[model samples]
Target: MDTLKRDVLSQRVQQVRPSGIRKFFDIINTMPNVISLGVGEPDFVTPEHIRQAGIESIQQGRTRYTSNSGILELREEIAALFQRLYGLTYDPLSQVLVTVGVSEGVDLAMRTIIDPGDEVIAPDPGYVAYEADIIFAGGVPVPVPTYAKYDFAVRAAEIEAAITPRTKMILLGNPNNPTGAVIPREELAAIAKLAIEHDLIVVSDEVYSQLVYGTEHVSIAAMPQMQERTIILDGFSKAYAMTGWRVGYVLAPEHILSAMLKVHQYAIMCAGTAAQEAALQALRHGDADVKRMHDDYARRGRMFVDGLNRIGLACSEPRGAFYAFPYVGNTGMSDEEFAEKLLFEEEVALVPGSSFGNAGKNYVRATYCTAYDKLEEALIRIERFVKKHA
Candidate 1:
């Protein structure tokens, strides 16, 4: 029976490790009064107007499946949003594809462009999905390590060194998870130049674009000669606090979009109709709500990062996103050990940075998306825990 079960599973599915973030979340569920700073989800509710739009769609009996590419109206809104924010033009009918979420967009982009043994270069300590998704699609994930000294920004020269004859794509998560490091415009331009020279595809995940502080979010696709070779994955989940709604879209050149749509049609059919409606509403009227949330996140980031540094964690100030990646090696423990001990001793939960990649082995990632008072308390407990270890 064991042999039969083993034979039933594909090697790829069996070999891909489960998400490291969820391991801590599962432990949190078994404990009480635990202040979790691990998950990267927004604490705010989806804007009221967005919710109302979803509700109205349901009330109006608009729950049938949309076109496999999604509703035209939502696609238009997505296109308009890109134009309005970054001055990037995408044809709503041919270049935009609605997906279940940015997760699906990632999957589709990988499978659409990668063949067996093709190589994709991505940052080390990146969003956890980047490596696994590449493996699942039968491609090789080449990780170029990014260091805290450089603010965790992957250098263009390092990326150039990693390129090989088999290299097919470059995957990027701007306003990166785990580190919250935003690559600056000049570095992005250099990367764009490399892609143009190498004839490689660039998959730019801009989900956190709107959450930046004190820096403009520049899309590589907006660079000269990039639109033809870049695939942009974005969604309302992060910006509008619509994580549960699971609506996102892809913008690529028509050829790439068509190929991705084929996979999306077969695998997902379409994103939820009401959710798409809600996302449309978010695009049309959620600017104020986004600004309100962005301001709150910026404030929270400042307070939390200051607290972490004050407590001797040596966290770099995150310029974007809501995470603080702090070096925990001074505690004389591995990141895993520090997180485990902190949880048990202080009832505070955060993810070990090694979960992201090997380069993050001595760090831990804490998110400040919790309420202000909760974050303050978590900081106090973390300080106590650090002192105890000291």
Candidate 2:
């Protein structure tokens, strides 16, 4: 019997597609000398000071599980940092739940609010996990497509149009993945207003909140009367280059937070003690490291976007995050074809836009999270490939 087939897996699990981002990388892993611009992760190591804190925690034998909600000290710092950055406030004891990563927070948020038939509206061409998370939680994921013409910002009208009586929440990633578009304050306010009108909860995934270049990141949670309705998911991974640390947190109303915590306590017990200590240090003293990395990313963003245009791939200037989503339709190849051909021909690996959503079909997402010299080399190869194809 093929036990893995048909009835073995949950229907919801089988209904969701595997992550399109990892599907290609699985192949790339078997190839040699490939320069991957496919993954959205900071190539930098965790800052020395932060690493030291984690090491110190182990040395001091503080290796036990923290409170199910997380260490109060870390939660307090997170609350303070949110207030400082977005002018949002939360009671550390009741409103914050430390998570394994923003990924876990995403799952927990969906599961907490989304009953079997509930709907959650999110941007199409968003992070791949958004849809899968909603589906796994037994909720319907309604995607509203954002376009390159509009710089990929999710419009309030599009979101409202997708809403039904079934929609219980709105999910957003500010400083969006794949596209690197940041929501403007005015537009965010409009969306918050719509959420309020519809009585829908908002889950604002601000993992890349600190990575913007010229523009400021506006938290929808900070809008008038929106704090109680918006759930903020953020962490040290992106800005601090601490991906392996696996530490993130969610901030929401006490009731919502408590329900999420109930799931988290059973599913995770607590985030790693060492990581929590390290994250506390990051919140307290990692400003210099964050600034240094952001400056470097800004330099690479300008160079990469300009290089893509020069190579005949029309790309909008990414205002935030470390990716450049360029229109690759001129190459006369599908998004996946362009990516596969680029990998085989030039040893350069990029994520196909369709991996994010069908709305991204004519584009490709290239991450600038690597070093400058590596980015330059990748661009040269891309230019050569473009000439051959275009």
Whose lDDT is greatest here?
A: 1
Q: Model-by-model lDDT, in order?
A: 0.93, 0.92
- On residues 179-287, what C-alpha lDDT tens digit does candidate 1 reach at each position? 9999999999999999999999999998999999998889999999999999999998898999999998999999999999999988989999999999999999999
Consecutive 10-residue window with the lowest summed lDDT within model 1: 1-10
Q: Where is model 2 more than 4 Å wrong at Cα? A: 1-6
TM-score of each: 0.98, 0.98
Q: Backbone clashes per model, in order?
A: 0, 0
lDDT of 2 by residue, 288-358 (tens): 99999999999998999999988889998788899999999988999999999999999999999998888
